[model samples]
Every structure is written in structure tokens, then in C-alpha cells.
Target: MKRLSVEICVCTKCVMNGAMDIIEAVEGLKKLKTQLRLNSQVDIVTRSFCSGADVCPLVCVNGERMEHSNSETVMAKIISLTSKDVK
Candidate 1:
């Protein structure tokens, strides 16, 4: 199975923006992996801060930076990336 690493910036500013929501959404997604037919394993990591603090909430999927990230966008990315290997 493939492993997808998701990093979320949880600095005070990030958290204030919406990082917590993204984290929660990701965790919920992990729980529904089987139901979603996800073929990859998701690893969620919370980091203290990232260089792109100006953007506040930031997420990286497999090292691909996503600035100004939100729960919907982040979850969609995870699903889209993992769905490529579904077949």
C-alpha cells in the first residue's frame, strides 16, 4: 500500500486560522479509509510552524506545499492523490 504524508502547520497563527479544522477532517478521513475505498495510508503530522507563516494555515501533501489551506481543500487533495492508485 502507498503511504501519503500530510503535514499541517499548527502555530498559533495557523491554529487561529483553521489548522485545527483541517486536522480534524484528516483524522475523520483516516477513520473512513475502508469506506472510502482508499488504497493508500495517510500519515498526518502537525508541525509547530512553517516558513509560509504569512499564509497562516499551511498544509503539505507528500511535500507539496498548499498555502492558505482549508479543510475542504486539504481533504480533497488527499482523496484525489490516493484515488490515482485505486485501480
Candidate 2:
């Protein structure tokens, strides 16, 4: 399957801005995906310092980066990736 790699910045600045909330939201969605048996594509998540320090709480979905990301915005982007992309 084609993996959707999501990288969230958890640096001090991002954490202060609520990066953890985004992480938890993604995890919740992941659980739901499993329950729904949407097992075609997979998500690989990671945490790191901000590559764009000016844009704290950043999220990267499939190499597309977004600044000032929140749980809802990140969730939308991830869920928009269709399962048909599974390899």
C-alpha cells in the first residue's frame, strides 16, 4: 500500500501552540480507520522539530506542508487522501 507519511512538529514552540492535540486527533482517526476496515493505505506518523520554525505547529502530509496546523485541518487533509491510492 502507498503510505501517507505525516510528520508533525513537536518542538517547544509547536507544543506550546497545541501540537499534541493534533497528534491525538490523528491517532483517534487512525483507530476509526482500523474499525472501519479502511486498511488499503497506511499512515506513518512522526514527530520532530519544526523545519519551518516561523510556522510553528506545522504538519506535512505526503510531503505537502502546512503551517499553523490544527487538529481539524490536519484531519481533513489526511482523510482526503483516498484509499484507492493503496499499492
Top-TM-score candidate index: 1
Q: Stretches of candidate 2 above 4 Å error?
A: 34-44, 83-87
The sequence of per-residue lDDT tens digits that candidate 2 reaches over residues 1-87 is: 556778888888888888889889888887787554454354656677576468988888888998999999988887777444432
Error of 2 at 17 (Å): 0.7
- lDDT agreement with native, every candidate: 0.90, 0.76
Query: Model 1 off-target regions past 4 Å?
Result: none
Of the candidates shown, which would achieve the greatest lDDT relative to the real structure? 1
TM-scores, all candidates, are: 0.92, 0.78
Kindly list the per-residue Cα lDDT of model 1 for residues 51-84, writing each as its tens digit: 6458879899999989999999999999999888
lDDT of 2 at 64: 91
